[model samples]
Target: MQIKLRLMVALLGLLSVAATAAELPELIFPEGVGVNIHFVTEHTNDLDLIAAAGFKFVRMDFSWESTERKKGEYTWGDYEELTANLEKHGLRAIYILDYSNDLYEERVSSLHAITHEEQRGTASPQHPKSIAAYARWAAAAVEHFRGQHVIWEIWNEPNGYFWKPKPDVKQYLTLALAAAKAIRTQVPKAKIIGPATSGFDWPFMEEFLKSGVLEYLDAVSVHPYRDPGTPPETVTEDYKKLREMIGRLAPGGKKNLPIISGEWGYSSSTAGVLQEVQAQYLVRQQLVNMLNEVPLSIWYDWKNDGLDRGDNEHNFGTVTADLKPKPAYVAVKTLTHELSGYRILRRIEMDPKDYVLVCVNGSGGCKMVGWTTAKAHSVGVEMPFKSVHRITGMDGFGKGFTPKVKEGDLIFKVEQMPKYYAFE
Candidate 1:
């Protein structure tokens, strides 16, 4: 009954945010949006909220230490509830196999030992035995969730603090390869992706690539977090560089491994960016990742993890801990709904402050999303469409407007926040 209620709510959202068209497929990546959810001890409202936002995927980091705390003693309390709820609400999972257990350690005992920092640490195993144990645990997890088509990301931010002590390219590749083998051994068709680094750690990733980590990966994963003010389009160059690196350094199939922005987002308070600006960042970054051909992009967080809005870490959520919506939350729903079946045709020619990206579908129809990247504006844009409606964004919906062709160009007003312009 709860799932039914959730689906009804998700369907109703389409009435307000969706375009007039036939029933479309669920939004997947390269064109769709998804969110990272931390429901370990939180309510199931996160799942409901994700479905309501029209997101198709939910990424949850499955801690090895938490599940298999005492050698073989397995507990599936919080995880089961979370995964079951996600399935119920019609969202898929990207389960991250990460962190370390005391039972699996060879050298870094203190690093692998669970502590207050285990929640934030990525103390992965070092020894062959410990690595094999992790692989076994990962395989067990894959077996348990076999039918759900869950994507397994080897670890999170291995090049960053998650690795603890310091990042070691050899160690990360070893664990990743072992986990991949174990997952494959258990579920041959399972999808394994990784090198889930924090940022573009050139040395770490290049070494991994040169060492052939791609041999075990189905997709290349990254956490491309950046400054809040950076336009999403600007980062396509960074991804392009990563692709070039893969081609130059890795083997044949490795060169073509798909990139998945498995985790990337801006924090309202954490990054010192305004909540509204955070909302705009959401649209821009997701669009940028999609345009760059990153098949999947997952926003880091869905709601504030703690009550301290003043703290940067606690303020990443698009909603408050109480389930209240932030501007970022609404923006996610609006941006995703407006993105239905739209492929980025090309970036239109525009002025400094103004930016225009055109998207079109089959049947020769084209639409655009325009924004000033800086602030709201009344700049004239050469939109080829005769008419348009504001589908969604942080900005309020605009009244229907008609564009006039001036000098062989249809001109319309563009604003700071993006607005969808569908052609008649």
Candidate 2:
């Protein structure tokens, strides 16, 4: 009995010694954060809420038709409030130069959908004369908004229904080229970004690259939407795929292109996604993009459109329809606060169900964003962590929770929910 008791105690001591986090070296990089904001006009608190979320930039619409309703007649009423709010908040703007003007389109397509004056389809004119007319509006708008340092994206999802009457790559490229030239001519210091396709439309992107439309633009942008129920970290592979595509498709043979995930988001109330799950994925998506070195990852939306929780379209926003923040808002706010100044060092691959993102800051201390692949499971980590602190991945605001720990072994209850662990 004594021999057996001694062996059990010895085994327990060995297990504890193997459980702590290993101290890792710092790996350095720089990353930026941004989000897509909607309904700034309707909600008085939208801009302030966005600013409070720690977003450094916003992707907002500067609709063309609304600005120049009459020929050569400029009205700045719609934009004055927006620019004022942006300047007040110190958040940069990526203003989309979008859609069709009634004066320029000889024949309007009924298939086009307009969401609050944001003409989403068949925005470019078919007539050559109308192209020149639209160019004037493009130039005038850029000139008016000059010195605000707002980025101009020629069109939104031009390769999808956002173009309308079936996406015409040739005509869309012509429209983009004309707009790019006009903006450069009118506002020399303005930054232009585009080919804002709905997803990876290979043919559409190829046309732009082969036609040298890339040379006229500042950054290549895409809305890399994933399938429902797919992991948000799936973007890491997608990002790699995009770099490969740009290297192969870009002009001058393998030219390095600055890629921007200008718009990306997952809808809650879709599939079996819980509200809490939505919040978890929101943080994961942004961190995945950041760790992969994508300069900007704009969450597709800022607020829910209505009070229907079951409606996926309305539930995409971080805030509820009433502008009350959801769990996602808090999760994002926390992520941006902690990871904003830090850079991802590497991705630690363990089993098929466990994933880890290694990160470091200016101080050389390291932190990790880790989550389980399948469902929840407890895992033991053995490493050289001097001191380890635990924060609940989704809701770590003011409360600090206890995680299972031993002498050299720390046990974490890993789940689909991402948890941040510190090793310094």
In model 1, which residue pairs have backbone atoms overlapping below 3 Å?
270-312, 303-317
Candidate 2 structure quality by residue, lDDT tens digits, 1-424: 2244345444534533422111011112222567787644644577788878887788887787888778889887778778777888877788888877777674435444324243333346657876777777888888888877677888898776666565788888888888788878887766778888887777778778777666666668889887667878777776687777777777773267567788977777655367687777877777677667666677877887676766767778888877888888887787776665566656665775686676655455556667775888877765324444542333333234555576666566677767766664
> Candidate 1 on 187-255: residue-level lDDT in tens?
877778888887788888888778766766677888888876765666777899999988898787567
Best by lDDT: 1
In order, what is each prediction's RMSD in angstroms? Answer: 8.0, 9.8
- Global CA lDDT of candidate 1, please? 0.71
- How big is the positional error of residue 274 in model 2, measured in Å on the Cα after superposition? 1.9
lDDT of 1 at 240: 92
TM-score, every prediction: 0.83, 0.83
**lDDT of every predicted structure (CA atoms):** 0.71, 0.69
Clashes of 1: 2
Candidate 1's C-alpha runs over 4 A off are: 1-31, 106-123, 362-365, 375-408
Backbone clashes under 3 angstroms, per model: 2, 13
